[model samples]
Target: MGSAWKQLPEELTGPARSLAEELRTLKDAAGLSLSELATRTHYSRASWERWLNGKRVITEQALDALIGAVECDGPALRALWQQAVAGPSGAEAGAQDTAAEADADADAPRVAGVQDTAEPVEVLPAGEPEPATAWWRRPAPLLACAAVVALVLVLVGLRATRHDDPSTPVADPGTSSAPVTVPAKPVSSDPTCQAMGCAHKNPKDTGCGKDARTLQSDVIGKVVIYLRYSQKCQAVWAAINEGQPQDYATITSSTGESEQALIHYGYDNYSLMLSAADPAVTFQVCGHQPEGNLCIAPMSDPAGMVASTPIPVGPASPPPGVGGTASPTADATASPSAAPTAVS
Candidate 1:
């Protein structure tokens, strides 16, 4: 049988082409047929077809599902997908626009009495000077402009050849008039806090969730616990993906700092972050259920393996300067619960 895939449209360029090609490569590497992908992921075969064929922009949720199904680098893929959503680069768009205008001009209707074989003539209003007599079009001015263009081209060529000349002196960083550009370090999208300042702050609002990853995950009874850590924020938090009403998870640092998240109506909830710059300091996420308390810590494995320890049911000790108010849950609809007060 012939290949099921169609060639990406010729108009696709820049990030859009990149993302589509990367998706195709990942699909090929996974060796999963479209039918199998539909069964495994939330998106149907037709949705995958459109994304892969560059007919539609892929949603974040759809991308996440595909990444999970293929086990690819989620962060890198997400970044590429975001660039694609931002559309083509400025230069590419300009070129495309220019080509479109040229095509439109080619197809546009001509003047009523103008002959196609004749040299184009410009029409001028009565009493106006002809463009042929303009000062800028004079021989001396035209020669000057040509000379300036030639000088620019020669200078550019010399600059391009400078790298190959050993006699060329390197510019001193302190004395050079040219501006030296330093690559910018990655910053959180919209983080309100950083490092210690992030303590007791909402991970989502602080933009730490953008680069967060599950350090460890465990399933106790029906509840699934995700021990999430954000290297960018240097903070850790606990998320309860599945749980009962009144269920909660507390993220506590080895330094004795803690924050709790309560689930009131839904099965999902996430706690506020606790500053944890040092991974060796140890951060634990303990989920509280009616049955008992189950705790898990970040493992050395990058695979996010969860090793849990069941502890007796009890309230966690709160950090100093922290009040009884538990940071609000991720679900805004649910009312906040009475948090565990600090004990002296």
Candidate 2:
């Protein structure tokens, strides 16, 4: 069945309209309902509706989540989103026009007619002579004149009280006139987890994925393995792409701590994080497939969290009798049988 998408607002045009249309297309291609999309992404259903309908601007995070969910080309969608955001939004332009019209109405000169609600002025007989009034009877005019005179006298007194003569020396206060220095507030840090607290935790959930980098990456047969590290969380994890259902990857740290995860859903999956606060510590990431196993030895870099020696990229398999090795703290051992050559 075709998607039953609501009509976008008439004001939405140009890049914004293109983005909204593309998002709707992706949603339909994924065969995900609005509620299902909401469940899979971080945004609420209502928020998704607003963004998809062009009623609100889509954030970068929300766009990334949507692309990831639908498994679409991230760079293409990101470029479209950037184009839409770089210019003034359609909603904002409409709002600006409305405000300008309201301001013009407010600043407009009103004529004395039906629109005017002020009390009408009294009209005496046409040619009749006006009666002279005493100053006391015209209290409003007299009071206004008296107020203006009083203001003038106060200004004169203030001017006379000031020491205008340059020859006169004023008393100096002992206090320093230098500006007071206020210490700046420290900037708030990101990543909710750190060090041991990040151990065994999902890197994405702990906000470590924002700054994560691949220390080592290698392709074995049809599957690719990545040794991912997060400097902010001080942790490392393993990720596998183009994996099978039973495919799993294990990441072992120098301290003998290891974490492993099996692919259960899509072709892409990652293992839980393991704390690696010391840069001197080495790590070994291994990916296991039905045919054989592949491992990369990640050398540590003292200046940064990057690995000094990255595994060569390309399709390669481990030597015979070389399977997934166990960490020092674990009791598992390698398989003695020779692993078969991987099929490209």
Candidate 3:
């Protein structure tokens, strides 16, 4: 993937082509394969490849991730990406909208018997006058007094309750009046979603957890992904190993609700932190083309999924979604099968 590569489309002139060229150059300088890039960045490798190949425009998120990956924080690159995304298509869409509006106006119905019976609305009194006080600024001392009394009653009730319970220590009258401190989310350092820890707890806990269940992969395509769920965590996450640039994968629930994640040019591997998608609704994973064709081709349907009991990970499995793998894009790019060209 060295200097020589497939040429960009001739139609991709102007900002769009400039952006694509710059992205490729930046990725090369970073010295990371597409797969490695995807694992490190939020955007997937497949998505990035499409942008670099001039198949589609990249998103601002993609540019941001690319900037981070290359360790270069430049405003010019962002501007270029913006221009590319807002290319001819944007202007065309605007023109189309304008034409539609004009056509609607021309076709509007008119009746000869119609009469203009409209009335003018009154304007605000313009005479000079003193402005009234704002609602919050009004004199409300009695309201404040009532609120303080209510607070005191609540605190006193608690104090009396504690006093009645000999085992409970009554809060001292001199203690800080600030609200009592309470831990926000019950967090645990252990990644394992144990029954006790995950009970009534959020799926994404403090640390990376063990794989509670592994999904079977039947369809193999440009991208190969595996799903794993932790009953304790009550969550499902995926680790994708194989994929070309611009490939995207989506997880849809039994109810057709879905969450979509994208792959960028150098992105190879990815793992999703399951949260929104509910386990009660059976979920399916589908891979999509970076440009389109989402879920059009999928490895397997989620219908096969069943109630999985807690199966703690043994010594056989290491990382979360099977073992993460790499892509071959970089290897081909380094030697640059053809001529070296400048994007900027």
Candidate 4:
């Protein structure tokens, strides 16, 4: 009976067909019968006929067997086999088949029918599976959520701190802490000082002048300094309240001096005067002044003469005779005979 492989179409053309043609050419060139080729390749005659006739796809092992039977170049035939399996048709496939045949002519060995056992096929490695992930597991989305949560936590912490802590104590420009129970240092009395409008005849008098005077007498001869009118005053006051060392300048000025005098004295309200000659000079700062001036009032020595020496600049020390022995007190004995008695 004719071979069942004969059913292959005459027009069947591709890498597979090209491989079959090369096998046939190899057999003819070697002048070998099917039985002889099969014996040399260690394959059955039927298997050889079927493979060469293109009845089944040729495997690399089978191609290797055929190369031995025909004494053909193994590398050339193996290369052509690889191309044939890669694609069914293409110019490259044809070229590869042609090159294989040319190489086979040069190196093939003659063979008579012979049979040899086939080698066992090796198992292929299994394919790896893809890793699983959830929709929210994407790196970008996770990072964005983390950032938002951090921001929210920060905002919440800040809000809670603001509410729980005390309100920032407001220190007036030239004044100490905001006036809570006591009013700020007196600036000017009501312009209308008629008894009906303001009880004090001198509108400039602070209502607590007596109290201030009493405090001054007790601390006399100690360096008494006050901050002038400026943002710097607020800073100094804050520092003082904290019990930190602070340096204050003592300014001495008369009532009738020009506004420029206040500026030179580093005071906002120049209405207040400092008695450089007072055993202990008193600074009645205008806690409030439209022009933002710091008024200085230095009670004169009992004799009513201004002291020629400037007040020293340093941290405020405890009053003499109160905490410890007094530093040589300014001539407190200077008589106040000509000094103004009324604070106003």
- The alpha-carbon RMSD values of the candidates against the true structure, listed in the order shown, are 24.3, 30.0, 25.7, 50.7
lDDT tens per residue, model 3, 199-247: 3333333233333344432223334444545544555544333344555
Candidate 4 residue-wise lDDT, 190-270, digit = tens = 232221232212212322121111112112122222321111011011000001012122233333221111111111111
Q: Against the true structure, candidate 1 has what lDDT?
A: 0.48
Weakest ten-residue segment in model 4 by summed lDDT: 235-244
Comparison by lDDT, 1 against 4, better one: 1
Worst 10 residues of 3 by lDDT: 335-344
- Which residue pairs show backbone clashes in model 1? none
Alpha carbon deviation, residue 40, candidate 1 (Å):
20
Worst 10 residues of 1 by lDDT: 335-344
User: lDDT of all predictions, in order shown?
Assistant: 0.48, 0.51, 0.39, 0.31
Write candidate 1's Cα lDDT for 1-344 as tens digits.
11234566555545555667777656644555555554344333444565676554555545655655654556667666655554433123211223333344346322111221232211112353222211111124554455445435543444454445554333443762432222222443566777799988876557665555445556566555656666567777776643556888877776778887776532345788877665456677778889887877533322122223221111111111111112211211111011111100
Q: What's the distance in Å from true for residue 162, model 2?
A: 68
Instruction: Candidate 3: list runs displaced more than 4 Å.
Output: 42-47, 89-234, 237-344
TM-score of 2: 0.39
Q: Can you write out model 2's per-residue Cα lDDT over 11-41, one digit (the tens) per residue?
A: 5645666678777756654656655565445
Clashes of 1: 0
Q: How displaced is residue 228 in candidate 2, in Å? A: 0.5
